[model samples]
Target: CNALNASCSDCLGNSKCMYCYTDNTCKLYPSGKIIPPSSYCALDKARWGTCLVNFEALLISMGVIGGVLLLTITGCCIYCCYCRKGKNKRYEREDAKFESQRMERKARQEERRNERRSRLDEIRMKYGLMKEDSAPYTRFDA
Candidate 1:
């Protein structure tokens, strides 16, 4: 209703006309004006000023941050997995090489021991300490 168009005769002396102005109005009161109050609404259309939060911008920022964190974590996991696989392969190769060398060293030591035993047997035979039919000396005999 237009406050200015109301007539005093229509009230039949029971009601009075009151003009609502912006100056004396409460800050929380709802106004029918299409434009918002400058105190509560920002000049920039993107913002809601001090009274409200910009949920669109807030949600978008959160999504972006979450995406970045997810990508970073994924990248780190992939890198760690790759590095661990490579390290395991390297360790296996080194272990196999070491095992082969150990086996070869054992074979060489056994050959040397056999050579020493043969030399001792030849010396015993020449000194007439053991006959051709006698059993060879053993570690337990010593």
Candidate 2:
């Protein structure tokens, strides 16, 4: 890909070649390294994949995109946690309300039972049907 007169499009035709805007020269892409070292070609001058953008711009764009994506994911996680905490608090409040209502109902039911028992006992005593606690044994006489 050392064609000095070849256009960037012509150099990019080969997958293993990169074009440099500094010298307008086509050179073989360095597959061993991640990015072409400054020795090979300046970052701003190096073009890979397409001739529309330089390597420096590509790196910056990719970095920005990755950072934004990371921040978005982090923000979503935080929001979810906050919502879940609020949900738990709501459930606790509802449970406490329900328990208080249950207690009130239970107390009313107990009061009604006590009142009914007392009325029955009073009627038994008035009719002389209730047994005396002092007298363990008693004979029935007509």
Pick the lDDT winner: 2
**Model 2 segments beyond 4 Å from truth?**
3-5, 13-15, 120-142
**What's the true lDDT of residue 53 in model 2?**
95
lDDT (Cα, tens digit) per residue for candidate 1, span 34-142: 3344554332321222213332454467789999999999999998999888999999999999999999999999999999999998998899876665567645754
Q: What count of clashes does model 2 give?
A: 0
Most accurate candidate by TM-score:
2
Give every collision pair in model 2: none
Q: What lDDT does each candidate get?
A: 0.54, 0.91
TM-score of each: 0.54, 0.70
**What is the RMSD, in Å, between candidate 2 and the native fold over all Cα?**
4.9
User: Model 1's lDDT to the true fold?
Assistant: 0.54
